[model samples]
Target: MTARVPDAPPHRRQGFGAFVRARAANGALVVQPRMGFSDPGHMRAGLTATRAARAHTVGTVTLDSYTRVGDLDAVEPALRAGTPLNGYPIVTHPGATTRAVLDGVAGPDFPVQVRHGSSLPQHIFRRLIDLGLDATEGGPVSYCLPYGRTPLASSIAAWQECTELFSHARDLGAEPHLETFGGCMLGQLCPPSQLVAISVLEALFFRAHGCRSISVSYAQQTHPGQDTAAVFALRRLCAALLPDVDWHVVVYAYMGAYPVTEAGAYRVLREAAELAVRTGSERLIVKTVAESRRIPTVEENVAALEYAARAATDNTTTARDPGTDSQTYAEAQALVEAVLNLHSDLSRALVMAFERGYLDIPYCVHPDNRGLTRSRLDEEGRLCWAETGALPLGRLVHTGRRREVTAAGLLADLSYLRRKMDREAIGAPPGTELTGSA
Candidate 1:
């Protein structure tokens, strides 16, 4: 909501990447790049040209079929000495059927990450299948609508869309997990009241349907230059939004001039890490800092991450100290409220899920399109499906057990389940029995 003010304290204009390096106080240094200058060939050529050139030239590059043409495998070993690659393979393709094949090609440099999207919903699943083919493939992916409390009808519809997609994929013999986040992808972020409602749906609806991973794009929702307190407060709110799920916070630094100063953009990340710690979050995905500039060459990207790692230093925190002051709290609170109101408008999508008896778990396992999600509802039906015993997203055939996202809820639902095990614990017991609540 505000511009980044690195020099000013938290009370100031709250909120704040690429390619050149500079020195810091203790003989330390940093690097930032010129904007609009990320072409793969230009970058590669620049690498070849810079050593001999008499003058500087802003490199020019283009998307090689939308893929970066740099040889990251070759570049990484030399550049990343102390820093570790996320190791989560980001496979970029256009379909679902590739899942198996991709899964088949798994290796060391690329552990497993399925990055699929950029197509209409119909072909999305098929692309996923393809990804699955490779041994190195990760969760089959698709972009889903935003799951925030933005209250925008369009904002929340994707949940159902994904529920349906999951149903269709299941029938086709493709089982995949969705990538979820609090905001982005038409999803909404909201006040606690609204978040409560949304979380209920997140837990129950996702459970009833069949979703696995629920991600939180927390960085996208944060404002830069804001003091650490304010940043921490916003993170706390996000924590409140998804308390019951095994979620992750994606730390996206200022890849651009959206609202952060270079120093402030530098600062927002530490703020984010602090908040994540407060939330007791286990997983953290730090997006590349050089993204806003030209396409980072393998070395440059690695360098950018190295800088971020140092920038996000002193990351020792706990659940109690989310660490936000008053002004920061107010700013974060207001943002959540606006997003929550928008979520109300989007409730139609949530309600529709109830009416239809199922909702899509917008899990975008792919890192493509900056990690978006997609939902489906069989081969027909625009928004809603009119069939009996069928959910809005599509027909649901119990996966023999239950949905993934709701595993947490299932444990809660099984409050009585534990007691049954206890009561029948004579070394032999039944899977479903109740002695009380566990």
Candidate 2:
């Protein structure tokens, strides 16, 4: 039996997606922080601070690890023992208490999103629905593969049910918005084309499951030019494929290794903001100076938010167009077409694509992943696929006798940006040459 969705006031409040769209229409980028606390007072304070920052901002309630993994039993003990969880345990917290945390903080102007890394988010979705929140971010494939050993089939089934459950927010006169984490697959080392393809596919999946408002995500990659091209590709594909759905593009700060130095981290974040502005992305998820060392404090998050806002203001005045004819767009379009041709349903096609190696993630070791594709950074610091495996790119990829990646070479590639930025933080020349598989 299907459980009934709870009733709430028909409050006509503008959701997170609408708020971002309005900001984008006015030439401002919405900056958000990934912050949550085990204590409600602290969470409330953090939200208040984020909303009051000197920038266009949104609020985030990132869930703790125990809630993410579905181990609700561990939550009570941790709370009682006064041990700090990494984020807010939403499912374990009382609904009224959570409401109190967001009181006067989350509204039409300052919208909030609940970000939980849960493959099976039925309970989390219920909590959000009960709390009258209408925005969340995650996808079955993206949340499952990188986080744990959850089977892809099970994750997909869970997400289908959860997506339908969350879509009922419209009944209460609020538009629910979902953001796909697919583009950040494996976070780094995966090439841009596949990332773009996955993000579009997940947005399609959400639409199929009754979500009308959605956001596509892309993480900052090795090269700035490539990243710009990738965002353009994402926007183009979303425009072509999802004409009926209300969608926007979101750029995530480099999700890979972070520079150890404060200056280096801030520089990378500033670059991300500039990328968002140049690509006409509506929103940016930011990282702080303490990203490499620890979970940042509320003050650090505010600082990062303000800095990104300033960067966006400075860069958005002059926009640059990454042409649709770029290599990234061509490759991404081909991948999207190949997956869509597999089946009428996007979710089924995604699973089959993985099984047949039609879609592959580089350096991903999940059981569902084929592990056939490999990627390396080129001389110009662009991520290039060294081995394309069975992806239906035809002549789009040209590796020409792939060479094995050494342990040292892999380490160097992983630390490429971190080392380069750290060196530039002091007085050192920029390193352009990267360690390639060849």
Candidate 3:
């Protein structure tokens, strides 16, 4: 039997979705950092700094690993031992402690979203409910396949319950907004069509489970033109399918293979900001220049936010591409339609799509994933599928001379963006390929 969620009174408080929508309406692109710290004081400071930056911004309370995996016991001991966690441990930290972190920083103007890579997020949702937080980002497939060995079935069931739990936040006068991490599956190498399909599917799942406000995500891929088309396709599909829901598109900075040099890192971020502006994406999740080395300090995150904002401002006049007839749009629409036809329920359709190989992620090793699909970076730096496996691309699938992705080829593809950006930063000749030397 399908679980029914009771409707709550309309939330008067403008939450994350409304905050992003307002910024978009004013032609301001909202930039956010992936910043979190174990200490509540540091976390609060980070949020405060983010809010104070020149960029139109949002706050993030990314959760630590132990808490993400549901091992709450390990968080306190590590906190007491002075060992720094990769992110804030929201579950272990008392509700009052988290409230202190967002006390003055997060509110109507500055909304914060919890980003935790968890397959099972019931406890996380419970914690967010208790803390009066209304926005969070993750998808059953995105969180499970990339991060761990959790079965897809288990993740789907858990997420259904979690979405219902999160929807209850509307009762507290805060609109519950959930962002789909599906477009970022495996971070990189997956084709944009699959990314778009999964992101839309996840947003539909959230809606079916009682969420009214949602965001679809797309990470910056290898090629700017391709990434722009992908985002446009995402926005178009969301508009057609989610007619009554309050939804937006959020683009993440290139999520794979950070550049080793600071110059290269900043250059990549600048391009990401330009992409957001060019594509008319409502919000962007920015990565710091310290991404390749260590966890970024609050200061570094602030600088990144400022830099991205400046880039967006400079590129505000760039013309938007109408991707209605683009190959990306056609392929993505095909994928989304194929899945929707499988079952009336979005969750079951997603599971069956993977099971039938109608939807496949390239280079993902998850057991539930059909590993037959393969992708390689083309000479033009655009991601192309070497093999489509069983994806329902129809005439869109590539039929060229396919080359196996050797270990050397894979390494080169991973470093393709970093090397290109670094050379550009140093004024190297355009189209000069790196020879693997510093």
Candidate 4:
């Protein structure tokens, strides 16, 4: 037991899963992957593996923006082509009021591609309403788009775009939706006001836009010494505005991850689950493991979720008085103070990073988006385009610093984590105890 496993390879070599499991238990690493939101796509041979993950709850199934109905014809090719998170629902944009976006998984068919910089008739609203008649499977329906570039106007505009569509959907009896990687949703370079503004915007946007369903997201990432307080604030806000709207949280599982590496993602998992419970929303989306490093087979995706579900713990198990049930207000305040003190030390370092230029965001829209168009190669042997090739944003964030999360970095991560941890946003934390039945 003292010695390393005989044939352990370098990555798995440092120790075995047993070693990592021990570290995670000590609070050194956040174990138990929680609130997974995944978009599974790979070569033709990867379909069966995708279906296998039906066990874990999946919140968001990101898609290839260009995928259309015609692409699903080939069996092997179609498998490789992509599948829908739910059956691909028809999305429509009528008048200037509609801004349709595609997020979630593949297997889609759009009525027609709308060209940018092209003129459109105002009467398009009727066509859009007609198109959306049967788009949803009658469960719940919503919309999404890349968080646009430009700091001020764009962020607000993106928010407005959702409002318009949500209003349109309401006119026709459907809920409204909005989603994006956290950082991009707020402006990558904007101040905290912009970040805080996102929630406020969603609250107002959904109401004025006539939508009842609302969602917010953060990048799937964290650093050492996570700012648990900042995470708490974000969650509290969701609880404040959204007792009714749906909340979704997604965790990205990939290789070389920090939180996953240091704490094993369970720390964040519990946080997200806590938020979900506080918000009291019904469904939550969780991500799949085996996604950070390589193109996962469907089996690997399911295995990752199963592993997280099997290992996750519940952190909000404190006893509640039977007579006095709702302490939502008190709970919200407590979360804020808790996050502040917890992240006091960590926020400083990130502030410094912000002051300096170490963290420049090159990609404007979909900054942390990890959806790859397809797992393919191009001329001269290169991994698809650089954007699609290397680790995507979710992959990068989930893989936090290899070093321990300093109190400073923790603040930065917690800011995002707070938004990420809401239970409605993510989901209930998976059971911490092992199932013995994978």
In model 2, which range of ten residues has the least summed lDDT? 1-10
What C-alpha lDDT values do all the predictions have? 0.31, 0.88, 0.87, 0.29
TM-scores, all candidates, are: 0.39, 0.94, 0.95, 0.39
**Candidate 3 vs. true structure, TM-score:** 0.95
lDDT of each residue in 161-214, candidate 1, tens digit only: 544555344332222333332222222111122222233334334434544334
Question: Cα RMSDs of all predictions?
Answer: 23.3, 5.3, 3.9, 18.6
Candidate of highest lDDT: 2
Per-residue alpha-carbon lDDT of model 3 for 171-193, expressed as tens digits? 65678999999999888898898
lDDT of 4 at 433: 24
lDDT per residue as tens, model 4, 1-438: 011112322342121122322332342222222211123222112323333343323222222222212122332343355543222211221222222222222111111111111011122223434544211100001122232222322333443443455346543332323332332232222211123323333343444444443334322223211212223344456555455544432222221122322133444444444433332222223344322333434454455545444444333332222221222223323322332333333233222222232222222233322232211112221111122122112222222223442455434433343323322233436332221112
lDDT of 2 by residue, 319-379 (tens): 5556577888989999989989999987788899899898888888899999899889999
lDDT of 1: 0.31
Candidate 4 structure lDDT: 0.29
User: Is 2 or 3 the stronger prediction by lDDT?
Assistant: 2
lDDT of 2: 0.88
